[model samples]
Target chain A: MLFLKRYLPLVICGFTGVVFGIQYYVPHKASEDLLTFINDWMIIIFGFSMILALASLFHVHYQKIRRRQSGWGFSLIVFIAIIVTVIIGIISQGETVDEKGLTSFGWIYTNMLVPLSGTMFSILAFFIASAAFRAFRARTLDAFLLLFAAIIIMFGRVPAGEYLWSKIWGAEFPLQMGDITEWIMGVLNMAARRGILLGVALGAIATSLKIIFGIERAYLGEKE
Target chain B: MRSIFHLLIFLLIEGQAFSQELTPPKELKAFDAPYDSGNVLYLTWKGMPYDSEKVDYIVYISESEEGPFFEIGRFKSNTHFKADKNWPAWAWKRTTEYHYFEISSFIKEGKEIPLENGKTYFLKLLVTDGIKQVKSNVVSAFPKGNLFNLLKLNNLIYMIIFSVIILWFIARAKKRELFLRKIPALEAIEEAIGRSTEMGRPIYFLTGRLGMSSVSTIASTIILGEVAKKVATYGTEIKVPHTDPIVMSVCQEITKQAYISAGRPDAYREDSNFFITEDQFSYTAAVDGLMVREKPAACFYMGYYYAESLLLSEVGASIGAIQIAGTDAEHQLPFFVTTCDYTLIGEELYAASAYLSKNPVLMGTLRGQDVGKGFLMGAVFIGTGLATLGTITGAMQIVSFVLDWFKGF
Candidate 1:
């Protein structure tokens, strides 16, 4: 049991990680075929894991119902939703919509899922404004700089800013807010973004090497 | 007077020569495409003038050079130069004078036929400007497989060197203590759990909306192990809602192990790491609803995130939760910084695991990463100096060598 749980997994992980890592540099047909084969297996595994997910879901909601917990009605709703969706999916042969019109699965998905998702997405607009209000309070020098930049960007994106600039300084003004905005976004922002990207890449590499070498097993539920 | 006479004479001769015919496609050759399986051929030709907009080159392919060649492709002249190819700067000279084309398939009567390995194919190039067509001699090429992609040699070499550096550091760290600089977010974990425990409210930990395949998600799960262990020790409820089932399963195991390691095996709850729906915003909506109702004391968002980052973090902030977020998503960093109490920027997300655990081997990897970053920083500084000097001084040739080398790196 220990071997199956611990050593075997490590060996498999180490072997596959190193193999795939090397496979990236090999342009041969065999290596490419191996990648395709492994990807197919992953897809198969993902399909099988859905059973475990559904079982967990059923267990959680079932317990809530059995105990007659608060908001047990919601748990009951979840159970009904899952069952209805699954039945519709299986009966429709996994097709959401047919040639003629909406199938049973399509009716549920188009009616229930899409609008709910849209509502959630629309909430991001309000969140962004609220977050921006917090961020642009100008409590510190950094906040002030952020506020300044944000104001400039907001102005530069519109034609009114250009018109005001031309009115303030003649048409032949050497500097423009548009140019400054471009410099900030293209030069300053790009340089900082590139630095962060490099750090992210290096970090990813370090973590991957740790995993492949078996130095990182915390993800395996191991202590170190 | 003599120069004008010479110019007229030259114009008379050159004009007649130009009016007679267009330049024929010359030195047409086909070879196996490099850095690929033996399934394509790269064809190169010369002799067409760069400004010839009206003229185009037609490429034909066949098994035999004698007859029955079919059209593979056709394109305008002065384009598809070798200099514009996608190969790395250091890999080839990329002769700008020659036009090149990659032909992997031929369409005959609307049916596509692919070139195969172990097959010798003949190709011919013809230059035409609506009226005149000039044909080049046939060239044959045999497609053969390559064992390695030399184009990615620099990438492979860097990987190997970085791996050796990390391993060396790991070995050294085993003998001596390695110093890991402070990341404030790692310190905040214990406090957040304590607060949650005191309030008797659960701490929400999300492993972002990514699967097990992503490195960010993997890092998040590693950090999840640490966070869950702390929660278990504090006897605080830790709820992990997952969008990916595989990740949820992994987190469940991690949570269980953390409980066992904390000597609170009975506190482990299987439903703590539950799967929400996979649809992105739907999952966000669900998590938002849950947070509003339950009002968790602390919220930990770790892993890759999308636009929904602000939505989740804002809700946490509204609930007065100590929201600690970590992700490598640079675009969303600003939102996290604005909303969350603590945000781990980019690489710090990965380093949090090592910092919190203080395991020598893992810490060594962090040290190695820092050193690697230092090296990159030095290279970027020198490269930028040289490039700026070249641009300002108009001595581009002096910097081209350095710039191209840096570009390859």
Candidate 2:
């Protein structure tokens, strides 16, 4: 019984896997209908999962409030926000995404969310500048090459480099540099991208094979 | 009996005369030419000339100079007959062999005529020019190859290059001497964990938005296990927030295992690995909140990420955490490059755990990747040089030919 309980899901998954796999090669109408039914079931399962997650969130925060924890006030604030949003969303006949009905959600998202998110994201600009200053020190040959590449890329992407060089060398120099930049990006970057893509492809294939063959079952969690 | 016999003999004689005197339409050669592809020939001929009164023309084709011909295709009672294009659509399959074609005209009350294949038959065209019949001289031509079969040879070069790279990697991996550089994002793991331990603040490790089985996520989980072990040994707090339930469960197990391995199983907290909402923005918001509230000393973001990368990293930075991020998303790399203290640019994310763990299997794979990269670099150099030299010297024709040959499907 214990073995059955533990392996039951795996067995069902395996059966479904084989069915779906073979369905690809089966041109019959019945096989197509079966695959469609399975796809619909998957969507329903995803919906249920979402509901369960929301419930978990509610339970956790509600318990925090009931216990009068130190963060109970914040929990209350969060609970009220969620409740009001849900209520407005439901009461508006679920058409809250429309222009007029979206006022409340839109206000909250724009005022409270977008700015905070955008501000957080903008910090990356400053961080990049600092990191570049420190990390691009050319400590080694590889570092120097990386720095050179970065400089060329930055200059090539912007128009100022061309303008400055065009004035210095009359005209042809900037054009030559532009050509070099294009060559670097087209050849060097494409090569690197291809290499990375190939590795990713192989890794994905190996991992997928492991999953399909049941060699990797870490996602099922602990045996018990 | 004599009257019946007289009627029958009269009818029989009339039918025989009609059969013998009726002829196909005249001037069957004056039709318009059909559309022509390079390999297929389509010819449209004028209707037979004999059908100016009450008959129509039927076209026929044959493969020899002799008497048998049959109808291959048909058209309406118009001034044209188009040859089928599919008959000779390829140059190699087409022959200069001569074939015969003819047309026949017939009226409703006249005798029915039969057409055969492979023999030239005289054809007469009949038309309702509203009054009488017109005849045209017969014209003929042999059917031959059309122009549609020119081979598209350009894709072969790409196939050759792709195969060479793949083969080279496999061969090098088998030999086992491919060198891979250490990724710095992975190198900072110990330092980040040690710093968090010393500071008495919990360490926060997020495996970005990828699910449990993604390569970057797997790499993150492995590194998380290692980091969790160190934290457990030092009796430091560790929090792992996951966007995927499956990943949360896996991380919990890995964390527990790590604690046990470190001989500090008692310090393991199962709840430390918790699932946040899977919505990209919501997860980022939740994680940002966690960072603000917990103010972890060390923050690690390792997996696949998108726009939320900057948001999470920025929050970590604001919390003054020693932030280390690794991902394979090229688009997100710029954000990570700016915000994270250490960022792994593409394949480096996969290389990180392998580099740190020094697992033989993973190392072998990394070696394979390096071999692939080297082969790609060599190809790039050769291709670029050829293209550039070709362009400079106006030798683009040769370059194009070579490229076409090498690039294969």
Candidate 3:
């Protein structure tokens, strides 16, 4: 049990990491075959872990309902939702879950998940307005610059900004609002983004090194 | 009988057309393909003639140079053939032994025959016009691996340099003192915890809608540990809702450990860190509801987020919460920057946890990363100067060479 809990995971991680790391340099048939086999093994392990996750979820909800705790009604609703969906899904499919086929599973997914996801996404518009109101305040020089940039970008995205600019400075005016916005987004924004991406990439590489060397073991939980 | 007589007449005319003068492909050669197993034989011939449409070229393989040969495929007038796919097991048996191949041209009506199993052979080419057939000279070459791949030599050198630099910095950091610039957001963690403790409101930390395997999520979890320790010390409640069960488990463990280390194990609650549904929108909705109801004083959004970044941060701001957000998700950065009081852009999220915890391993890795960034900045400066000079002086050869070298990466 001790070995399984501690050394086995470390051994597996080290072995797989080394093998896959070296696999990149070797474009041989054996390396390709091993990659395929390991990928399949990963899929199987992921499936088992998913089952464990479901069990944990069910256990948590069951405890909440049994204790009749705060929001116990919501827990009952969750149980009902799961049960109805599962039963309908099983009955519609007879056994298998065919994603493309017009079964109850597909209907439930398309009707429920897709719209709910879109609604959550659409809710972002209101949030954006609220957030913009807070962020666009001209309190300092940096804040004023951010506010100016935000206004220019907002104006440039719509046709009214270009129209207003042309009316004020004539049609022959250089650098319309749209042009300024494009330059800001394309050049200045892109440059800053690239710098951030570079730093992030370096951090990721360093973290990977830490993991490979067993220097970072926080994910293994509390140090015994 | 009348139909058969008409078919005979048609065949006689076709036979006459097939017997017309047509030249054979020249400069026939066969060699093993480079950077591949010995199974593949690459064959090439001279260009097609004007009358190539009237003839069909067939590829044949045999074990022996004797009479028997098997047709592998037929083409109109291809000058080269990659004989890798659709070969027999014996042909691609992963051996250094060579096999024979023949390129033959015949009338379109020529029947393809299978070869008999036998001994060793070589390559041959046969050209036939309905009645007569001519055989060309044979050629063969064995496939083998080279000791080194010269193409990827530059890449190998770069990898070694990078590895050495990273290792050297890590070793130095483990032994020697290291300096890291202070991140304001990380420093504000204590302030956020203190505010929640004063207001008697819970602290809500979102680990993003990602699993534990994600590096960003790992950073968030580490940050969570630090925050939990402070909260435990202050006896302030903290709620962590996770979309992934594995992450929830890890967060629960980290929170428990934090409380234990803070000597507030009695105040720690297991129910505080719990799993929400795996569904992204459902998880978001649940968290939104929790925010509206509980109205946490301090909200920390950490890890990789998608569309939900704005929704969560905006809601937190609406409740007048002191929101601190950190993520490597560049697209969502603008949203977090707009909503949160303090936002850690990209790698700052990773560095924040390291800075807060003062974990030697993390600090060393972070310092190594800074070293890498410094090296890159220097290289970029040099490269830019060279490019600008090359462009201005109309001498781009050096610049191009350097660019090609970098492109090898």
Q: Which ten residues in a row have the lowest lDDT in candidate 1 chain A?
A: A52-61
Local accuracy of candidate 1 as per-residue lDDT tens digits, A95-115: 887897889899888989988
- Candidate 2 residue B337 Cα shift, in angstroms, is 5.3
Please give, as one word, the docking class of candidate 1: medium
lDDT of 3 at B151: 45
Best by TM-score: 1
- Give the proportion of true interface contacts each model preserves, from 0 to 1: 0.81, 0.09, 0.41
Using lDDT as the measure, name the better of candidate 1 and candidate 2.
1
Pairs that clash in candidate 3? none
Provide per-model DockQ scores. Answer: 0.80, 0.09, 0.34
Counted clashes in each candidate structure = 0, 46, 0
Residue range B344-407, candidate 2, lDDT tens digits: 7666665555466554444555554555456556756777888898999998756655443324
Q: What is the lDDT of residue B311 in candidate 1?
A: 91
Better of 1 and 3 by DockQ: 1
Lowest summed lDDT over 10 consecutive residues: which window, candidate 2 chain B? B32-41
lDDT for residue A220 in candidate 2, whole number 0-100? 39
Candidate 3 chain A weakest ten by summed lDDT: A215-224
Looking at model 2, residue B72 earns an lDDT score of 39
In candidate 3, stretches whose alpha carbon ends up further than 4 angstroms from where it belongs are A1-8, A67-69, A94-101, A165-178, B1-156, B265-268, B386-398
Q: Pick the candidate with the highest lDDT.
A: 1
lDDT of 1: 0.88
